[model samples]
Target: MSTTADRTPTRHTAGVFDIRTIIGTLLGIYGIILTAMGLLGDPAYDRTGGVNANLIAGIALLVAGLVFLAWAKARPVVVDERELARGDDGNAVHEAR
Candidate 1:
């Protein structure tokens, strides 16, 4: 049986969380909340001009969410062997045999 260490080391590229992705996720949640409130006949309607606020917010969230999702999916997550090989000083030091 091959152990995890013996197996190929998965590359973990740094760009896991992007600003746009985080913003999109938060907006999505906010939009969902507004949508739910609007649909559930919450008092938010009275404060706002009309139900359009919720509708627009929801649509915007859905669109942004999809876009962010696509971007996150498209960006490749690669394990950087070169970076790993390079030490903190950006130099590869090999021990003398």
Candidate 2:
């Protein structure tokens, strides 16, 4: 009675509020803002020994955020239908040959 569709593996959908995406996007946006401010060559930075702290920190944050996003994409959770099936004795049943 089972069709090929029934054998397909399913993945829990990434929630509307996936933490990785949220954090990465927020960090990327903040980094862009900070980097832009730094590139403007603000006088405030001159007071800090001419170090563009905002630019350096923003670039680092941007890299970190990108890495997080990439990690999320590279690995994902999957649950198979056969894995979910159980027998009357509460043991997993194998539908294999």
Candidate 3:
């Protein structure tokens, strides 16, 4: 008897709950807050360096956050189940209806 078993690994992918999503969400939130502060923050910071560094840095962070979010969306992580049920003939133990 020649049994050519399938080599597919058992994997249960977790959708929208990966590390990328977490980092993206957190960065996006911080970006929003900083951008808001940069726009509406007090004018005292401007006197320190004669420039609104907060506004500029905030905008940069906001862009970075958006990039991370987009990257996560573009490529999501996949997790698979570790259970594989095979029959004596290298076939699936259960048949699909």
Alpha carbon lDDT of each predicted model: 0.61, 0.65, 0.62
Query: Model 3, stretches more than 4 Å misplaced?
Result: 1-13, 45-47, 83-97
Cα-based RMSD of candidate 1:
8.8
State the lDDT of candidate 2 residue by residue for 1-97, as single tens digits.
Answer: 9997776654353532456778888888988888887787573755778688888878888998898787556653333345555323443322222
**What does candidate 1's lDDT look like per residue over 1-97, in tens digits?**
8887655643564354555567668877877877776566554656776555766677777788778766655663444454566545443321222
lDDT of 1 at 64: 83
Q: Which one wins on lDDT?
A: 2
lDDT, residue 3, candidate 1: 86
> Which candidate leads the pack in TM-score?
2
Model 2 pairs whose backbones collide: none
Q: What TM-score does candidate 2 get on C-alpha atoms?
A: 0.64
* Candidate 3 lDDT by residue in tens digits, 1-97: 5444445656543446766567767777877887787789874564857767767777777787788777766665544333333333443222212
Count of clashes in candidate 3: 6
Candidate 2 regions with alpha-carbon error over 4 angstroms: 12-16, 41-43, 78-97
The local lDDT score (0 to 100) that residue 59 gets in candidate 1 is 71
